[model samples]
Target: MQRFRYRFDLTSLHFWIVIIIAIISQALKAASVVVPSSNCYVLDNSSRIVDFGSDLVVRFCKDVESRSQTGYVDFGRFDRFNHFVAGSGQVDFVQGFYNGDLVKCEHSYDKLGRTAQVNIICGTCPNGQCKVGVGCICNVTYESTCRVFVELAIQCEKPGPRVFKGFTVGFHPRTWEIVYDGMTQLGFERSHQEFSFATEQTHVYLYMTAIASLSTLVQKPIVKTFPDIGLEVRLSGSGAAGKPPTTLSPTALVVDWRCEKARDTPYEVNITIPVEGYEPIQFTLTKMCEFTQTQDGDATRGWAIFGVLSCIFIILSALFCCGGFIYKTRVQRQHGIDALPGMTILSACLETVSGAGQGYTRAEDINSAFANEASWERPVSAQGTRRQSERKYGAI
Candidate 1:
């Protein structure tokens, strides 16, 4: 029988060492997963991006009215049919919407990356300290609940890893109020389904009323500006169907207005709908609240003040030049360029050029002497006298 011997090659040993080191490095990195903390009360429907791995991240949101909190974790996106469970808590599925259209969850996973399946876990933590991946919050009067607004979970079929483009979470509490008195004033027999809500960024209202058919005009976005108040509202169809109408005259209209200064100053929302051959319906959804007009007035006043100051400066400069010219010519009896108000500056500028042909240490004085004795200063008859005498001698 042949003798069998085993010897490890040096190259194989080096390769094994490198592989072992990489595995240990990844393990250590996973062991040290640090979850960042944020103020729950301040984040209103905000989201942050996170990396994908065994380690997880946590984001907290709060509702001031209910005195409750919600935590959201972005587990990237899922490609295959996989069950996700929180490491330390329970997770439940959350519903999502697209442009006010409900995105219903389906049992079939054939929607590719078009459908998103998001899971949330709600609980309470001690002293505001909570573990990552588990949706928990502290300093709440009640237990924390998982709530979301417009969160997306796309299922992509691409071969590479999917990117987690952040999502928003928190309750968008929509409140509705009946515009009964206003509708009665507008002479509408049956006007209902009109309400409004305000946020820091925008103030939105929805107005719905029955009217005659508008002949294919329901798919356009209608925008009206109230220049007097520095505000505008864009009207679109409420998505009773999956798609919202791009324009006006839809069955339902959602009015979106920008009220960035809503808290600082009051705002008014006035909506009007006209029919082809029927009485126009009007809705004064909000009380007449004046937008602060002082800013524009202040701007106008500032520009006016700047114009006055500029005019005064120009007048003073002209007066100084005229006075200097009059004083130099009349009182000092100066003539030629010296009598001009700006002659000093002009002479200093031309000093180098005028004295270039003359050899002198002080160029300005030498040029002035040459100007005083120039041939042009002599009378025309005296200037030709020397030349005429030379011609007479030559003729003799």
Candidate 2:
């Protein structure tokens, strides 16, 4: 019993270990964990104003990963930029980063806590230009009296009006302008949308929640955008009302977005980030969920695992029951108990006693014990009384 109990404890430990291992394996295979998605946006250049407002579709694709975590990831970078201009006159437009991205950013002193990432500019500009080529720059250039300016604005549905703010690197305030924030004494200037930028460096803040003190009051802001929104890139030629259009929206700084994971997503914003001295380019960033997902693969794996476990259980149960029965029968036989059935039972009894009782064969014992010798001797006792009496176990 002590040995059996010890064995049973060991078996129980093994069983628990197997269960834990199975559970972990299944969890890993499930791909149900919440992870960052792979969603991106295509800058696809900027489309100019031709028919009041030109229609443009931003082509996007979801790069699905091949694994069990099929469709559960979100987050991507802007990738391509292609612009089309088909206007006979100059157009008006505005372009800037989406405000939704800015407000959702969590700011803290710890670098690890920040979820946003800033891509460093490549050292090789290809051309002899600086911030105007790769970094965010807005170039607004219009004819004679029409002044152009690059502006940054953030919109949150918070209290206090509509929560609007814009920052500029060029031009002065108009008193009651939509947003009154800008860099320098008179804002920044346009350096043309080309590799040869001639504008001075100006640091303008773009609605970043960077203050550690404001962390308590500023939660993530709600941002909404319409990808189908179209803006007219109004441009007036210096000559006449009807003239060939010039590609003003510079291609020097075209930003695009793309999704790298397998998941569906939707457009988070639609903004026209304008280049300095160039037309305001219109573009949209959408969110889509379409990364590769599992097709009952987890369930299939579970079935396979269960099948193997069940077979092992059945085999063990059969072995244990058979072993117990054989052991019990062996013990009973040593205690002189009948273990055989039918004719074999009688034979088994005779053989067992014959081994103990020496000089007594099974057939001789049966014959001499039940023969007429005892019965014949019993008749002599009856003759004394002139009586006939016979019995199998008669005493003389």
Worst 10 residues of 1 by lDDT: 161-170
lDDT of 2 by residue, 1-396 (tens): 999999999999999999999998765332111101221111111321122122222211332323223353332222224122111212222222111111223232322221212221212223333333323322223221111222211111111111111222111222211112211111112111221111111111122211232222222222223332221112222211212112221011111223233332332332232223222222222334244323345789999999999889766765665566566667768887534422233443444433443333454434433343344566665544532233222233
Worst ten-residue run, lDDT, model 2? 156-165
Compose the digit string of candidate 1's lDDT tens values, residues 323-361.
665566565344444443345434433443344323323
Models 1 onward score TM values of 0.24, 0.17
Go through the candidates in order and give the C-alpha RMSD of each one to the true structure. 29.2, 33.6
Model 2 residue 365 lDDT score: 39
The per-residue C-alpha lDDT of model 1 at residue 274 equals 33
Candidate No. with top lDDT? 1
Whole-model lDDT, model 2:
0.29
